[model samples]
Target: MKGFSMYIGGISIKNKIFISNILIIVVFISTQSYFANTISQKAIIEKEINNSSRELVLIQNNLQTLVSTIEDYSKILASDYRLQNELYNDLLLNTKHEDSKPVGGLNNLSMKKTLSETISNIVEPNTKIKAVSILTSNHHWVDVGFADNAYASRIFGDGYGPEDRYYLPVWTSLIKFGFLYEGEDSVFAVSKTVIHKDTGKMIGRIFLYVKETTIASIYEEGENKGGDFYIVDSAGRIISSQNKAKLYRDFKEAVSISLPETGKDTTFTQGSGSEEMLIFTHRFEPLKWTIVSAIPMKNISSGRKEINQLILGVGAACLLLALIVSFLLSRSITRHIFQLAKTMRQIRSGQMQVRSPYQSKDEIGYLSEGFNNLMDRMEALMAENVEKQRTKAEIEFKLLQSQVKPHFLYNTVETIISLIKLGLGKQAIQAAQYMANFYKISLSKGDDIIPIGEEMRLTESYLEIQQLRYVEYMEYTMEIDHDIMSYSIPKLTLQPIVENAIYHGLKLKKEKGIIRISGRRNGNQLEIEIYDNGAGMHKNQIKAIMDGTSVPDEINGFGIRSVSNRIRMLYGERYGLQVESEYGVYTKIIVVLPLRYH
Candidate 1:
């Protein structure tokens, strides 16, 4: 019985191990299949979304093309009308000889009577006859046959008045299509030339009369497609439309539609309730009118529903597959999870030395490297933050110190002005004025840059005061180009260099020293030079200043350093002030800046 019990226990243990191995194999195969399917479905969905976006863009382009074509057509029509009218008037003016022909008794009377009757019929029946005249080159009325003659009678009648004589030069210069009078009812006219059969010269003028109805007809014809089409005047008033009740209406509502300021075709929708519509306005360049076509939004988007439904059906199927695959794949994708978990756990426990293992060269590997990089960046950022805080505090202290020096100088100048006023009158006034100018520039509302002209003026004021103290010890000349005077430059950039040249370079010199200040344009750069033939520095000092390694003993190298820093900040390190000096001969400071024009 003991041997049999041992055998059964051994078999049961073997069976349990076999079942566990098979279950592991099955789970692995299923997870792999799910991940493959999920990736495939996602690709299809992304492709479809991209295609839909492209289609929408194409539709917008098509609409813009249609709007542009219509606007071009309107412009051509307006140009053609103007050109034809000018040609007709030129023909009539050149044919003054035909007016001298004598008329037979009955033939002339019958023809004149018929012409008068035709004109009266065309004019508005309610309006009375003002006058009628046939113009000659001599500026006299040849005949006034009757109240009803031809199309010309309506225009020449009482509404025109006797002062409305068509002067030859003025008539020839009139535009083709425009309102000639400002009354309740406007008149539009088109000119035509009537030539003699034998001579082939223009003997008469035929003016085509256009009443309010003519414009109304045009608007009605254009608005037949169920969208509102109106003829707007240059001032944005609706002159004619299918809806006569809305005639002469102010188009402020439509004109208020926001459009891109760039002169291009644009569309916008506005208004509400029954008035809501999508308006497409294109500028008619020749007529100076904005031809607007408004269509209901519903009309444009109605057909889109069917296409959207088709997209929806395809999208729904894709989404269902994605969800099923995503669920199974989430369990299978353990590579990224394992790496992330290891790194995170190390980070949580305050281990900055943690790094992700470079396992597979795929997205997972990239993610691991990215995490390590992020950690390195965080450490660097903390160190940089501390350094930045220290630097900012230093800069604030320097700025405060610089501010106090200017105020103190201003106060001292003011005291000197009072003393000079009591003793020396002329010197007092000059000193006070120079002092005012110097303080104005020094304070400058804390502006970093001032115009080149202003800076030159400021430097002159400073030099004026310095010359009084030095008394012909130094002579300075400034030569600046007129074109570069308006360019912006850092304030006090030239003055400090001039001061350094005067005090450090020229102070101990026995003979008179010459300081030259000049500016010139070099390609896209402006070069300013301050050179003095005074006591110059050694090579070692020049190197120290350029490298920013050593500070000057007398003055805190703060002024030169400030100018250099400002140039670097405004332009870049590539542009700044350079110092070059030769021992006991000359010292030159050159400032380089980008050429800017206002």
Candidate 2:
């Protein structure tokens, strides 16, 4: 403290200030450089981890090819004609005619000699496979023979019932075949019980050795292959590896395979310090093996730490801090602007109730309050406009429906007057009563919706009056399906169509015109058909009626198109009326509507 005081006293005040500024800048630069180096190392490690995953997939493919090669060879050896014939003769055919003289067939010893030659020819070429052991239920050999009927079947695999001849060739597990490859470094043995091709018997077995070094060639592509690769069985045993020392070792630590969130394969990291490894794994389900690529975390970051990058990082940090301070100084003004922008966005998205909650006596505050007041006015106006639209729709629907009623009323009233003039007093009263019931269903307690059953009754009542008026020939039948009797439809829906059929259709026909009304469910809608053997319209007349354009006065007066329009308005555009007619042959008015029950 005394030496520092003397040095400070020696220098001027201006020199002390300049020295302090230099010291501050040096300290800031040094601290920023250390942090920058850490960040860069982490980034490098992340990139390397991604590269390791792609490399792991390549390793998995190579190992799979090796496993597949072993499988293909096994299939070839199992189906060889000479090998199968010799084994079958020794095991099955030779046992039956042991001493019998058949000129083409060989005795057991001669059959064994031929089998050994056949097996050696298949096994010798593939250096990856070290040996072959052929055994039969009646005869057994790694090559030399011993006859034991059920011994070969039970000895190869576990869970073998007396009748079971199948042996699963699970790699890296069998100890019975260990004696066959005594001096050899065997990775696994591919074994399968050979079934007799002709008799369906467990005739023989195929046991072959796959050398351990063959697995090393799968992942170790060249001398410079970077990853430490290995195969781990389900028991945590290291089945095969590039390192010979790790082979057959209990590698319990390598068994913790998991699925990471970011990667595609079943890759997981294990342990934490020097033992920490980024272990990328792929499960080869065909061979029942888990292939792994273990990479050290330290190796990922093994590179020169460049201090030149530190200078650039420190400069960037200083600029960023300056910007942050400037933003903080102006945040009070910008925060309100941001709030106003957010409020306008909410309003634009149809949330009209949202308002800028910031309050102040500045110009911006007045603007925000004005925006909120404008939104309130807009919301109120929208409600009023929606109400007006609903009222207009209801009035239009009532008008379309009321048009049907007046036309029918005029026709019925004229029938009553004509009946009175004809002196049919009782018929006039009955026709008047039917008209009253028809209007009762039409009113439907001041509502437009009525059951389809009631609509049928309305059609019937109108027809009854028409039948009385034209007692000579007018006839009708309601053939509606009972299932849809409870479905609901608009009031006065069917009556207008039936009225149109009578006035324009059946009246013009010379034949006894019959109107058949049939209703059935069509997909999600109810279809009601009004078929009349009457004077049917041509294509142009049907088009005008369907287009809701001008029609012949007799047909147009009933407004069948208006019924279709009412249906579309109530149920949407898909539900309406359709007309199918052939001139002077038939007229079919089909009404399509949504199936509603109330």
Candidate 3:
């Protein structure tokens, strides 16, 4: 220990500090990892198993409610007095008229029309319902929905016994085992037998049908949980499953496992090695359905493993972090000297802007300040100062765009949702795509500069989405020269100006407002003007904005100040924004740039 202490003391203080911190961090982290792994491993596994079971139960309840709701709807339809009367008459008519085309007579047509209207009403409210059918005891059918009646006809035909009227067989009857849903869709059916209470006579059967997606949606979360879900009957037949190829197969065939005769809802492990599965089962006893989840046991243990690995990873990270922190600590003790040395090294490598940011009243601070002043004068002489200014403008413009983005995005999302609700789905999708493009180009993967063409496209997309919400009152036109389209410009230059025109100008107009953007190049400079025919500002308002004496409220200038400052700062004081307007007549904003927009 004495020899080691002498060795540490002999080295430089920076190395000594670095070594000491590393040893301390290693010791502390090793102890923490030991306790964390030993104490929390089993607890994490147990808690995770319980959480998985709870999630399974929650998903099972959703399925239970869905099936029960469909059955209840079937019940309501079966008990419909008019529907029953129509079916009973149809039954008698089929038995009398040979059941060949029941729509031949006026009375039959009227009965069929009534049944169609009733079934349409039922299907309208529930988008998931693919079809609803009514079949008399004699196999006469009235079907309403998009699906072909051929499958329902074959499933609900006369070959079945009395048990077929229940929900389990009704679902199973339509499924073909080992047939993947990709080959043909699975149409799940729920049957309820119709009968007259007073007459004590069987009239017909009402069947409610939906695509497998409707049932799969109930357990969609389970599907994403690195597992598969199945609805099994008491007979152990797999009636509904996410991997539809296994539908209607025995549970044993899908995953063979031994079970206790407890007839209980349980979670247990099955199989060996990679074939192992963590099985979760919950019974829907009312309909004799068991919702089963077969997840890989590996998934169950992954949490425990990740926690153990995470602790070890944290230990490794801390060891690395300690070295960096110790080095920084030694340098901080003589920060002025260290920073001045670093700045000198960076300037040697041609980084002129690398000035020591440290300032103080000490002698070392004066030395750094003198060094920084020398570099500043040298930077200006070298003509590299413009690059520094351009970088500053880039950062400020990026911030400006980020600040205004959320407000515009929030408004756009509402418009998209409204379009969807109004059943203008195509328009909604188009608007959403336009919104994506607007942000995509405006952001451009952290690039503050973009082509003028890209900026125009971004502006157009923004306008399209805004027009979606105000089609009656707003429109825009762009007349930009193709030659200057490839010119480099700062991002978000024109959009904010147009946005200001719409919000502060056009929105206040009593009539429809038009926004026109025209661009032209003058020598080495490019000029773009945004004109809006609406409530224009007065001379005083424009002065307050240009003089920077306007109200500090965000909505007042409508973001024009930020755009103006950014332009002048990037190009020069000669370039920026100029406003012209007459109150209640029109507003126009002319933007000057050296072919760059910010």
Candidate 4:
């Protein structure tokens, strides 16, 4: 089983599904075929039986109409005063001529002729009647036959039963021709008693024989097809049948089957030997008779065999269809999967631009699009990393340059010497001490970031040294927020801007210029503002400086631009320097940085 599973797994999905569905289709066809024969056999038998019952119902209706008409004939004969007087006169004549009875020979021919003519007038009009006869209370009788040699005496004799009771009509069970005649057979009839309408007294009994062939005609189709048909009374006595031997036989004795209590249509099997037959029975409630059909088991089995073969043929066609559909659906799904897998393999092998070409709005299509988007983001990040590296190196070189610039050292040394030559030892010592403090904080042990307090101290020392050098020409003020003194900022960030203010703005002014430096914390940001009341430059000059287009001419020392770039590089573009100035009024440089405590 394990090996078989591996074999199936190795095959393409289309073939696997085709194979699996073949098995399923086989099972389905097998199950359907079994049930089709098992269930449909019973269903077909029931439907055929019900169909036979409907045909029998039509025959029953015809029989009822014939019987009802016969009853009407009896009423007509009883109500006719002329006919009643003739019957009474015949009774009197027969009593007087008792020796002239027509028993062994034809006696009283004239009387018989007159009475036969009278009965013929009524029974001859009805085509369904084979013979009609009357028996008076005094035992005088006469009969007329519609068919040749139809012996009314043989068909119905003096034997009187409940069916022949006075003033009531009833149908009799089948009986044979009383006196064997050529071409004569058994027959049944509807009989009633005739009465004098005015006196309401029973006169005599009268009977009408209906040809047995009429009952046989009801099931002519079944008989032609070699099947037996029967009409039985409610007592289960066969009243009429195609088979003369079956007529008058008890139903249970002939077929060994019991009728249902509801008298509905039913089918059953009877007999075990060659007599075995499929019997279908339907009861006609109006006639209180059950119509039955019997077909041999051999005949019924032959038809069932044909039906089974047809069902098998249809099942085979459905199985083939399922196979084709399964193969087509599996192929569509696996084709998309294969394309995605191939594209993923290419991507794994460093072909980042490769993509699956599935454009359908399905799950596979979504996965393909997601894969392509992921590649795009990866490529963008790679380029951004390279750019960041280049910018970092440029900022480092500028910081190195600022730390070792020679003119800054030379100017500070000359300022201290001039002060020393004036014999102002204390001021000279203070100037030297301030320069020492500024360099110590600016270097910050080679670290680029320092506390806000130390950065401010560095700027203050440089301003004090510059003030001593320009005494009357330079004035400075510092307004530092003590709360933000511990916040971290880029080292030497403020000192460069201050130096630019003095060299570019304050130094060029004629009157003593004021340079104010203030640091404070604003929301999530730390801001240091440098304002100079000097000869401020125009917007064009500030733009050129910010854009790195202006060349530094020894005194500017790349200080402002370097500080702006370093602030942006370290804390992102949102934290940087903004310059605001007016020509000859005031120049304000605000350095913004993210607030971070050391």
Candidate 5:
């Protein structure tokens, strides 16, 4: 009986041991799976945020580039106005000489050759003539290129009726505008007034032909740089395109597409009947035209695929690592270790409230609970440090603000004295009055935010003083949006920008240069830009200004660095000075700030 009882007890003990082992294995597997999933999800979320932020930055850069190109084209077109006016005047001055010609003059050949040579020099190279005719004031037309059978055939067409020749709307418009036709074509024609050179009396028209292809070629050469380019006229018709026929046949359809309402960069997808493309449209205000550049969407996205793949690969590796770690540590002790590790990771990632799972009185559990208490104390200390830093920044900003006004006043008074010595009494008196008004609002009894109008007046006072001192070497202009002038901005915000432009940009130039001060409202933000058409800095100089690494002792333009620091101190790092320069052309400094205090 004793032997049988012992055997039963042994069986019961073995069963209990086997069941405990199995339970431990099950717990380990479940914990491992949870750990792997958490790691993979965290990595994916981080990658997504990083990629999204990078994409936003790239898009913003591209938009700015597009806007800059449009502005450049507008400036180029504006410079062409004088050339167009000159051409118009030349036509009106030559009206009398053609009328003096005899009906069958013997010297007609010599006169035609001389006139052709003179007009050819004025026109651009590679120009072709289709028809040269003299039109009388009474509406009679005389064909000057009668000897050229091809020209006569195209124009006369075996008769003198309108149907015999091509009807040119441009030519008709020119004639109505008091131009004497010298040539006619489907695209453009040239005409001069029919006045005798000696008598200067209106006689008849001297017509010269212009090749439309020549002007089109000029514009094409100017705009082409490997991308698809097209020009849309003021009326929104696709007048010319890199692929002529593709756009020509669908002119009405293309015209109906909405352009960017403002002078902003915009992107659109355009195509029909197997001709799809991505179009980037930039407005050229001076020409009253839109320059559209198109690229294949597939091509642009193909480059992005590699970056996408890289991100995916990194994500996959992290997920695989998490899975392996979770599977390997499936025991109960390992589960506790993983939980503790996760809690530590959360604390490191700034979640201070996280705590380890510990419910036992064993050594491991005691250590975990003690670690959690330590983390709580550390978090409290960190919070105190953050508050201290905030207070310090506020105090430093106030000190900088206090220093700026006194310095500005002393400089203004010195400038006034100099103006008085230069025999400019009335100007000095006016400047002093402006100085008083400027300081009244600038001080505002230590107010941090002041009206933008007050800032503008303060800037104008500084500019006025500088202009007086460097009258022969400097010019200044201001453009402020009326609506935005009432918005408040940081005090002494613009002085450093003006100082930088004059000292760094203009002072280096040998000849007198221009400085432009402009402002505009962008949503809830106020943008103030100071640009100088003077000797610009190199890329290295601009880089040093932005990074704040360049020392003031090394260069004379320390004011730029000061302004940048003050802006950062007041508004945070996101709002500050942005400097851009092209060697020998211009330098621009932009200061961005919120319209109202946060």
Candidate 6:
């Protein structure tokens, strides 16, 4: 232990901390897995046992009720005097009818019709009774139910005799040994002897047929995945089961499970070697049947096996989680050192703007602050020289469109003259004042880039001045977001677009027109849109303006290509103007600039 402690002390502090945490986590996970597996095994087995016992009790009650109901119905038919007389008259009286065919003298057909109605009335109300038949002492029989008459006659053709169970005085308990007609499967039967009250002689037998599924259906309410359910009689013969192939087979295991009539539930593990099964036996005394549920041990233990796998998975995930937590712990301590190294490399490559914003009072923070001061002094010296060169280049770019500015001023002066001549002296003064404000902001000490707020104020002045001359022909609105007012953009960017929209487009249309100016910030760029509802240009005219080949109209001074060129020169090629127009519909011009403050 002393040697291990000395080795950890030799390593860095971050590595020591990471290793210590990993060892603690590994020991905790191992202990948790051991106890969780032991407890899960016991809980799963108890749950399975309880679920099986509940299912067995539920099926037992349902079978007992079904058997009792069928027995009661059979006894009811046996005591009906009208039904007994119908069978007797049909057998004893026969004569010649008007058609010369042999018939009964006492209206035997009427009695047979009455018997048929009684059977329908009795069987229709019960969904379980598949068929009902009356067999006489002389082998003459009639059946009135769902079973085919020919099939029923062939099955019970042998009439009542000493060998038949129906000859006894009492109703027979449900028995599995019976001759089921073709197409009738997994069935059991019960019968009662119909005896004449006056003479104490056997009249006929009342046989009620029911499918064994009537009981198995109750057991099938829940899906029993692990085993097969069997309904077996006291003779150890399987009566009905979910697996139809096992019917009538001898289930010696079921009979031998609860011998000596203990009258209690029995559950045990049966079979040998790896091919073992778990057997559960339950007895129903009224029907003398045993319900055996046999599930292979391999099948029942599958749930326990899944729980074991889940525990192993959790252990592995915890180990991986420990490694991840250790890695993050080490990284947190070294983050500032790595960032300081990267900033020094950037400064070596002559990037002065890459300053570290870290301001801690530690040694690394002092180093970062010293590096930032050195870069700030260097940047101030370089910006003064760079600003002079940029201003000169901008002056050269603006001279290309200088002629348009004088022409615009000339048109505005002529509009004020027209307003005064129309006897609107008050409106003339407002137009002149708006024109002066527009030009004052336009010059802006010859700086090419100005605040967005000042540019927007200039556009409002220009539009209002134009509206005075074309008051009935045009309307205008301005929507500017307050957030982007401090961003810097090129000067006189919007006034040229708005002037063209009013004079060339809206004036050409006979209807009054609408002009809208809107500004908003989109990510790293600012979007200023000039939209107009006027006589828009055709596809060819828009292409010519974008290509800088369109001839300027007499009234319109500035061209769209000039504005697109100046913006692309100030920013990169990514920033420029986009034009969209459809003939006789509308026109929109979008000016894009980088989001920067002067």
Off by over 4 Å in 2: 1-28, 97-113, 120-127, 142-184, 222-227, 253-275, 304-598
* Rank ordering of all candidates by TM-score, starting from the highest: 4, 6, 3, 2, 5, 1
Error of 2 at 71 (Å): 1.0
Q: Which rank order by lDDT, best down to worst?
A: 3, 6, 4, 2, 5, 1
lDDT of 4 by residue, 1-598 (tens): 9999988778976677677888888898899898888787777666656655666666667766766776676666555665576566655565577787633111356656655656676664445565666666555445434433235445555545455455667666666543223365676766777676665555566666676776677577443235677788888888877776777788878866666667777778777767777777777665688877777755655668788879977887787788778888777878888888888898788787787788878887888788778778876886697478547646654554455446567788998899889998899899889988987887788886789889888888888888888878888999999999989987777877887788888888999989998888889998889999999989998888888797866445477777787777677878899999999988999999998877
How does each model score on lDDT? 0.57, 0.70, 0.75, 0.73, 0.58, 0.74
lDDT of 1 by residue, 351-409 (tens): 87777776667787777788889988986896696567546534733563375357546
Model 3 over residues 206-244: C-alpha lDDT tens digits?
767666667777887553348777877778777777777
Best by TM-score: 4
Q: What lDDT would candidate 2 get against the real structure?
A: 0.70
Candidate 6 lDDT tens digits, 1-598: 9999988778865676688788888888878877886677567656666777777877788887877777877777787878878756644542123345434322356665777677765574555776677766455556443555465566555555564644432333233323325554545666678877786777678777777677678787765546778877777777878876666767675334433356558877767766776677789887678887776766766787787788888888888988898879766755676687778788788777898877899887898798789778878977875676456545534653475567768888998898889988888898889888988898898887899999998989888877876889999989999999999988878877888898778998999999998999999899999999898988888777777576755424334666776787678689998889998889999999999997
On TM-score, who's better, 2 or 3? 3
- TM-score for predicted model 4 compared with the true structure: 0.44
Report the poorest 10 consecutive residues by lDDT, candidate 5: 169-178
Give a tens-digit lDDT track for model 5, residues 1-598.
8998887576633344444555554466556555655555455434433443343334334434533443333233222333223222433433434566423331256644543444343333422343344444433344333223344345433333442132221222111111234433333333444433444444434344433343345345442223455556565566556565544333447544455667665666666534555556666554455656665544444444565565556556655564454445344455565578789999887688888877678776887888888887887887787667557645645554565567657877887898789988898887787778777767788786788888898889778867866888899999999888887777777876777678777888998999999999878677899999888889997887666677655223455665666667666777888888898889988888876732
TM-score of each: 0.36, 0.41, 0.43, 0.44, 0.38, 0.43
Residue 393's lDDT within candidate 6 is 43
Q: Which ranges of candidate 1 are over 4 A from the true structure?
A: 1-423
Worst 10 residues of 2 by lDDT: 144-153
Off by over 4 Å in 5: 1-407, 554-559, 569-571, 595-598
Best candidate per lDDT, number? 3
RMSD of each: 40.5, 35.3, 44.2, 17.1, 48.6, 26.1
For candidate 2, write residues 1-598 as lDDT tens digits. 9999998899744345555555565567668776777777767766766776666677777767766776677667777777777667666565676678423343357765876666565454634676666655554453433212133334554233343345444354522233332433444667766766777666667766666766777677732225587776666678777777766677664444343433235655677887677777777667656777777766664542344455566567775664555446446556787789889998888788898897778988998889888888988998897667556556645765676568668988999999999998898999999999988887788877888989898888888988987877679988899889899988877877887787788888887889999999988989999999889989988888767566446534436776776677678778888899899988998999888995
Error of 6 at 365 (Å): 26
